[model samples]
Target: MSIEREDLMICPARVTLDAAQMAFFDGLPTKAPSVQAELGCELEQGHEGSHAALGQQVDTTMWWIQWTLSASEINPYTWCPATHLPDTERRDDKDCALFNGHPGSHSSAKRSWQASEAA
Candidate 1:
């Protein structure tokens, strides 16, 4: 997915929401997506030495039941901060959604643009 200019501000370090804000997540409607299990994790170097940031990586599996929870009958997909996104690009193949709608684009295009080595 293309990273919007606003996405540059997205950081996991700044935890703005308070405990009360997350209290409702526990009561998320039955249809709400659930993190039933954490299959595994792949850690990468963080900006600081010896510290790693946790972002979804290959071999890390999360099972979710798609659901639309509402507040005052309004779906809050826009306000929900925990939107799911893959941390790394895998491939353009069907098995991978790195290029789900961009058929002709090379899977390594982003990597080349970013000038980073593959994981």
Candidate 2:
């Protein structure tokens, strides 16, 4: 009962990262890390910048499809924007380190590192 994902639809959202963030990302390793990536994510693509630059986003639960989008393609509106939730009473004041519109659960919802928690 497994579906073939080779033909699944993908999200096409693309945005520009702000100058500071883009500059920071450009400094990270693109294919291999000559320096420590400093990221603390647990996903296979979460290790280093070089690895991430070459990896594509792969979560199916998000309202936006990102299986075909590259990690390099995502540029959040801002860090810890907290604009995704519709709830008025969650009362979670902890901010996520990942950018807005990131895939998977927010960092505030979990203690460990996640796919989009990279800075």
Candidate 3:
């Protein structure tokens, strides 16, 4: 089945960077803006608390970045090829409202846990 891009609601893709990469990204003050302009979407920096769960202490100094996607730019099914078919189909039915008020859903909990353990 083919899906129309404009009919899909897209969410931001969050990425966690290692210390070195974070440093590079931060070193260039205009990096975020440049990326945002090129992608035609917001590229935001997430806070530490958003990186880990409440009351959790993390050791590694990782930085979080989010790339906001527009409905015309992403098709959940195509973007997340490994995601279950049901989930891909659900995005359209739900109008991508699934992430409302759910910051935890976007948090890099797994990455934080792994980084902390590695430290």
Candidate 4:
């Protein structure tokens, strides 16, 4: 099965996942559930500073949400494999995509969790 590429989004708040959010993530795959159940999740913080490359000075701001997911949970969301951007089929949130997919693919609880997340 192929996950879509647009549903993933790096949460901007850099906040920890709430109970509902945690529940949502728990239904993705065995790997994701296990990881969420264990280490939990954390939104990523961006790097701050300047660097020189090729004799040119440049500045950059990076952003992402990082969580200790299992090997199987890696790239579980629908995202551009290369760019990591939301793709055409990607859901607005990971939970939506997770529950929307077949139970054979993952878990069924995520869909209900996503509904709560959206409200």
Best-fitting candidate, measured by lDDT? 2
Models 1 onward score TM values of 0.20, 0.26, 0.19, 0.22
The TM-score-based order of candidates, best leading, equals 2, 4, 1, 3
lDDT for each residue of candidate 2 in 27-114, tens digit (9 for 90 to 100): 5444322222232232132322311111111221111111223543332234445634664332232544344445544444332323
lDDT, model 2: 0.32
Clashing pairs in 4: 4-78, 5-78, 5-79, 5-87, 6-86, 6-87, 6-90, 7-90, 7-91
Better of 2 and 4 by lDDT: 2
Each prediction's whole-model lDDT (CA) = 0.24, 0.32, 0.27, 0.26
Mark the regions of model 2 whose C-alpha exceeds 4 Å error after superposition.
1-35, 38-77, 83-93, 109-119
Q: Please count the clashing residue pairs in each candidate, in the order shown.
A: 0, 4, 0, 9
Arrange candidates by lDDT, descending: 2, 3, 4, 1
RMSD values for the candidates in order, in angstroms, are 15.1, 12.7, 14.4, 16.8
Q: What does candidate 3's lDDT look like per residue over 42-70, in tens digits? A: 11233222221111112322222323322
TM-score of model 1 (CA atoms): 0.20
> How much is the lDDT of residue 92 in candidate 2?
39
- Evaluated at residue 104, the lDDT of candidate 3 is 22
- TM-score, prediction 2: 0.26
Over 17-114, each residue of candidate 4 has an lDDT whose tens digit, in order, gives 44654554454332211223233222112322211001100121111123332221222223112222345242233322321111222211123332
Where's the lowest-lDDT run of ten residues in candidate 2?
56-65
Q: How far in Å is the alpha carbon of 95 misplaced in model 1?
A: 12
Off by over 4 Å in 1: 1-13, 30-75, 78-119
Worst 10 residues of 4 by lDDT: 50-59
